[model samples]
Target: MPFQAAPPPPAPPQAPPQAAPQGAPFPVPPPQWPGWAAQPPAPSRGAASPYPPPAWRPPRRKSGAGAVIGALMGVLALVFVLIVIVGALVGLSDHDETVSPIAIPTFSPFPSREATTDTRPTRNPTSEPTSRPTTRPTPVLNRTAKNNTLYRAGSLAKPNCRAGNASIYNHTQFKALILKTGTCMGKAWAPALERVGIDWSPPKYMIAARKGRGACGDYPSPGSNVPYYCPSNSTIYASTSAMAREYGPLGSWNGIIVSMMAHEYGHHIQSLSGISDSWWRQTLDSGSRSGKLALSRRHELQATCFGGMFMRSIAASYPIDTTRRNTLLWAYSHLGDPPGGPRDHGNTRSNAAWFRQGYTRPSAYQCNTWAVGSSSVS
Candidate 1:
């Protein structure tokens, strides 16, 4: 009686299983797949199932649309890459087109001397001298005169400047010979200059007996033995005695006289062409003594070239035989600047070479000293 425990209540009574409802579809059993547990017994109607239903699986989606979209995106990416590459190539081409190699500057101040083909109309030498157009074009002055239009003119006409038998020793005969030579020079050069639109007029001639002040300066400044042209007066001044002393044994030769006169006439040509004025301006503006001397050498050498051109033009009529040619070359060799002296004139080699160039080439363009390097003019 001291340790008695109370007893539990009795269990409720169980009801019988119900039958299937009318017109209800029967449930299909799951397939027996490998590695799965066996099917459990079906529960009574209206009763809960013993196991959870299998997990739900959605229907598979079509891959066609996704594949097509991905392919389009890939094509777009490829196009973008190509555009970038093409743009880069085009930019490089543009840069190459704009940039060029740097040109080296020359030391000479004049324009380039590269040979150019002359296409200007040439006058016929056989035509009458007065047949030129009544209207004449004005010559181009300024720095352009250094490389004037005269250079483009055709070869100088031969005036047939025949040398007379008169010896340079006779004053009257020498004067006649010089006058005749000058007349022939005018005939040859006047029409040539006119063709180039330069005014043509004969320079005054004077055979002086003594040194006196003239339009340019005193005649025969110290150590100068040749005839001088005074551009200011457009006259040539030469002394008979000076010529005799300068020429020595060659004084009797008419060829020597003609050459000397021709050289002076060359200066006259320069003056008429405005080259002398342009050259003088450059000389005055030169910064150093050496610079002035260099320009002077070029000027003198150019005159020598002109003299040679005239000589060649008249060679047939003047009958420049072997003896005369040799004498002229020898004279040129001695006409250059003396050693240890002011080098205003070119050296013997340069003077001779330029003269030979003019004789052989016979073109004013060939005598363009300003268009060459200093070494060439030197």
Candidate 2:
């Protein structure tokens, strides 16, 4: 009976073997983060794990006071950079822009006295351009010269000028002479302008030992060679000091003096007719020295023609005998361009020839210096 007990333990009923999971076995889900939902379960059994444990990683640490200090320093550095940029801008705003100074021409007087005898024309300066004419077309003033009737020779009728024979001696005498001559010029030219329907006015005459500065800009110091016509005020500025001292015995060369006066009057006429202003614009536009020189030559040559015409008109009244005529011609011809100087005035031959053209032809059309070749003006 005791041996039967051992068989009794084996006799405990055996349960049926457990079946494989139905459908498919699901994988355990990964742990959820504090604020996140649990992830979905992995795929069926026999498949590699769909959700594996996250990779090994070092734990995160909080920033310390040192890190905070470093961040503050970087912010300060950024502020410093902004301050420097603003300072540079403010500094620049405090200064004025630089400007270049304008150049002023100085006095280099021409030899004061006219030579008694006709001397050989002064040789061209070592740097003078050859006399060959430039074939290129020159820029025209007076609306291309064609449209402005004043530029045409004989556009002005003959000016029956009176003889101006003032015995210029002292400063007072010279002043009187110029005023008388200017008055006579006004009388003669006013009517001529009226005939052409061109406006006319009496030009102011200023005779001084020195012309410092005026509407025309600075005058060369006391001894400058040239007399200037200031269009700004319609004034003629002549150096009585120079003329009296150098060409003294002024009474002897009455025709020459009058002719010189007429030359400037020609410029005044151009101004009245709006030709000079155009010429000046063209000269400024020319830009280059040579281009300006060409334009200046044309301007002066035209004035020369005008002077000749005026001289011819007054010839009977003024009595320009052969010797006086030669003197006048020599005065013009001898005024050669200064060697190595600006060819603002034409060469001797061109100067005299243009003058002669105006004198002999007595027509505005004949004196169209603007239409001639550069060599003729040169």
Query: For this target, which candidate reaches the highest lDDT against the unseen true structure?
Result: 1
Best by TM-score: 1
How close is each model in CA RMSD to the real structure?
A: 37.1, 39.1
Model 2 alpha-carbon drift over 4 Å, by segment:
1-147, 151-165, 210-212, 218-223, 249-251
List model 1 lDDT by residue over 1-378, tens digit each.
011111100122232123224322211342343344777877778897678988999977869999899899999999999998777656644433111111112112221323112223433323333534566456664435456666666568898777779766566776777889989888877888877777789999887654556777766656776688888889998776677677757655677677778878988988888788888999899999999999898788888888888888888999887777777877777778888998987998788877777777777778777777787767
Residue 8 in model 2: shift from native, Å?
Answer: 99
lDDT of 2 by residue, 1-378 (tens): 000001001122232223224431211342232344667887778877668979999987757987899899999999999998767555543431221111101111222123212244433222233553567444343434324545432433334455555655566767777777666666656766655456668898777765457677655334354567888899888776666554554347767777777788878877776767777888888869989889888888778877777777766666666777677777777655777766888888888887777666655556666666677878
Query: What value of lDDT does candidate 1 attain over all alpha carbons?
Result: 0.70
Local distance difference test scores for all models: 0.70, 0.63
Candidate 1, superposed: residue stretches over 4 Å from native: 1-145
**Which 10-residue window of candidate 2 scores lowest in summed lDDT?**
1-10
